[model samples]
Target: MTRRRLLGLAALVAALLVATAAVVTTRLVADRPAAPSAGPSTTPPASPTPAPTTASPTPPPGADLKGPLNLLLVGVDTRVSIPGWEPHADAVLLLHVPAGLDRAYLFSLPRDLVVDIPAYPKARYPGGRTKLTHAMSYGSRVPGDKANPSTAQGYELLRATVSRYTGLRIDAGAVITFGGFDKLVDTLGGVDLYVDQRVASRHRRPDGTMRTLSGGGYIGPQMVYEKGTRHLTGWQALDYARQRYTAGGDYTRQRHQQQLLRALARKIVDEGTARDPQRVEQVVAALGRTLVYAGGGRQLIDFAYALGGVPADRLTLVVLPGAGVSSGGAYRGEQLKPLGRDFLTALRGGRVDAFLTAHPSLRVKN
Candidate 1:
């Protein structure tokens, strides 16, 4: 996948990860297929769902959760069909569940933000500066050297890069593929999206040609959206999240990604996807296919359960504090500042609310 498309998938993965916490229950059967005994596979298991168990009492909505959680949400830019291929991390999000689970903080890192990659034995640069996104590619494979790196190695590089940049460690993480993203959205039926601005996509046409406007230049794919609320299918949502050609560029893209997550969460809860065992099973199955979980399933499930009652309004979205600048010619990077340092300080001290208060400009609409 191209870098931008991969970023879109990152948003999708976050939605799925969060949704799992909302929908999965212990009583829910592990209907998805099992993993290969010998090695890790990108494919999600498909165990059959058993008969329904006794109905349980519904928890009160907006229930507050206990303890804090940290997750490194990474969108892997590789085809699910092609297992074992190390894809670059197109999108990286730091999903933080604070001491009170009533709210969430999703912090985004621009892919072009430059950072120093640590030296890996026999690897390029053995440690040198590069775009944050490249850390995944470099760690994913040895390339022409034929010494392939495991998916975990790629994540380690990414985790280290994020920690170095943001001063927060990833307690757990998951790598979601494009295929898994498509499946989860389709299973959810669709999500409601509130567009901040009009978006015109750059996806190719069915004729293998680029879409164009009446004024002449190519318009790419025609998944256009006005600045209003609308429902998006799995494909439409992905295309919408991938848009980056507007005036806001990556910043706008990140905002839309955050919106997509909120929209998906609302749909999952409002539409009652969490209460239906069969549906939850299907959703979990779809997630299994796409998720390369860093923390095992049980912990994520427990985390999700704690916060499932929380609604979209409680979730907060914030981009890492920075301004975009050119590196020389065409290369671009985000120059982060004292805001980043301050935010990290607050985060480490378990005072995210203080950080947000100090940097009101960093907050975005949910």
Candidate 2:
């Protein structure tokens, strides 16, 4: 799937993680199990319920979460209800919650960033250098079964690729589909976001239906998101986030994705949705229906308790500097600037706060 079509999925995983952590302490509970080994052949369970095993008891609400945790959040371009379709990572975000757990840093990795994908024997993929997004597609192939691809297997490979690139261990990860993302927004009664730029949807008409193709481009009255604060329904928000034709292109889209997530998280907390038992249940159920979670041996609920204290205001959005790479006059992919690499180095050393302080431009204004 093209990255443009599934851009909104990034916001879904981020919003879900924060929302789940914010409210799970109230009533969510499940048996904790031992952390699964990497590259397990078994498919991830459809729901977040951990396997029944006598491992460490689930942590209580407001428990102290370990510091310097890195989570890999990916938005895929597939539907949960459908099978036999290969999925690619449409949106890739890495969330870093400092040891204090008082705040979190979220950043996006351009889906088209150039990277070296390692060989995966499970899928018979002798990987090569390519766009980073292709790692998921290469790893998802079922060795003998061409009809169905394993998202879990694909996630493992993607995780490894990201870990290698960033030089950090992925403590946990989660995957959500585009369909699930729509449901999540609607479940919360939509979201209110500031339109940083006017964006015209390439896939949708003014009435929210798919745009028709003519002369190699969409033909219809475009759905336009005006520049201002507006309350948006699920479809509208998704369409807006999916647009990359704005001045900043994918970078603009990335900012919007982060804004959407913050808006969703703010709504959950500001509206008291997190504290309401019934509402929390509805949100949790919606997540259960949509999310494929891997907590690196930790339960989702544990993360909830650990990160419960992180409010929306404390979350910071970061944009890494990069430029387009081309070969033979053909667009190849993206490469990070030197400053971006330095930021990653700081992240590995737990000096992100200091680094951002020194280079204020890297921090996205709220």
Tens-place lDDT digits, model 2, residues 145-256: 9778888889889999999999988887887777767767788899898887778889898888999998888887889889999999888987887787788877777778
How many pairs of residues in model 1 come into backbone collision? Answer: 13
**TM-scores for every candidate against the unseen true structure:** 0.74, 0.84
- Residue by residue across 284-347, what tens digits does model 1's lDDT show? 7777756666653335444444554344566688876667767466656766677876777788
Q: Which candidate's lDDT is highest?
A: 2
Name the 10 consecutive residues with the lowest summed lDDT in model 2: 1-10
Cα lDDT, all candidates: 0.65, 0.75
TM-score of 2: 0.84
On a 0 to 100 scale, what is the lDDT of residue 331 in model 2?
100
The best candidate in terms of TM-score: 2
